[model samples]
Target: MKIKNLIPGLLVLFSPLALAHPGHGGDHGFESGILHPLTGVDHLSVMISVGILAALFGGRSRWQMPLSFIALMIVGGILGVSGLVIPGVELYIALSVVVMGLLLWRSVQISHQWVTVLVMAFAVFHGMAHGAEMPFNSHALAYFSGFVLSTFLLHLSGIAIGSAVLRFSASGRLVKALGAVVAMLGGSFLLS
Candidate 1:
């Protein structure tokens, strides 16, 4: 493969580290939930994969899934801020990357309603992680806006990449490969 074709793969491999936010797990006067996704590798992968799956599926599924995730995430965040305990939040997040990647790889299509339920469930874990990490005294509006916007953009970026891949002849196989990679990474996360 040429350097151009390799760029996306490189980007994917390096994304978690590249997007690492400062003051992560530190006192930033920011809500933990808002910053949670930014600091965690699993969260980053799931968010990006959500966007990619949206683009690959296209139509209403594209917008609907991510929107469901974002909306539900806020509710989760609220729960997190309230100190509500959620078990295995991190593990579920890692699993989300694996699940979404596989779904995209197979080019699987599910009913819109089911998709809504699934995305909402995952978003709660994501939101809770973020909410739990935020500082209680932080500027609430900016903290919330930053995380929500960042998550949306990550999803959008994935959508864009998937769209671009669709234009290629080998895109289907490429997607499956991406799924495998995500699964591997997720498994590693789970074990660690």
Candidate 2:
């Protein structure tokens, strides 16, 4: 695809990375805490893609998968704050992108139970990153809330986008193609 055509999607896809937080210092305020995930491409893409996949394969999987991610991510955050570091976090995150991308590309019908485990694993890596980056004085709860809310919205946006895609011809094929695109992005991220 031409760079121009890719620009809009790429911007939307990577907007989260451009964002940053002032952290919850003495007077940084709530919005600062909330927008943390909006500053990272990896966080943004993974969260949004999770939502998209959930919607594409609607039913219990929708809620189960994302919820699993949120829960595990919180645990990972705690670990990060406690300085209990987990190695290969970046690799896991990159793998998440690749796995999710391939799932979307193939429209894979993963078992609902397995989906939860997969999401949870991915969440740990994601959450740890958040924890590592958090400001020392930031209000922990508020910062977490910010990321959770942002992630939820990204998922919702994915659902909406997936719904739109379903209206087209051979949506399954198109979605799989989209998945391939996502996987390609993940590959690029790994290389970068």
Q: State TM-scores per candidate.
A: 0.79, 0.82
Q: What is the lDDT of residue 183 in candidate 1?
A: 76
Please report how far candidate 1 places residue 178 from its true position, in Å. 0.8
Local accuracy of candidate 1 as per-residue lDDT tens digits, 20-135: 44466635533443455667667777887787777766799789888989999888878877789488776777777667666666665565566567778989988887777666
- After superposition, the stretches of candidate 1 with alpha carbons farther than 4 Å from their true spots are 1-22, 25-36, 109-112
Please give, for residues 1-192, the per-residue lDDT of candidate 2 as tens digits.
Answer: 788999898666544343223443333324554566666566777888888777777787777777778888889888876787678777788788888888787664776567667778888988887777777667778777777777778878887877677776354888888788778878867765
Worst 10 residues of 1 by lDDT: 26-35
RMSD of each: 5.1, 3.9
* Candidate 2 global CA lDDT score: 0.73
Q: What does the lDDT read for residue 69 in candidate 1? A: 92
Query: Against the true structure, whose TM-score is highest?
Result: 2
Clashing pairs in 1: 30-135, 31-134, 32-130, 32-133, 32-134, 33-130, 33-131
lDDT of 2 at 131: 76
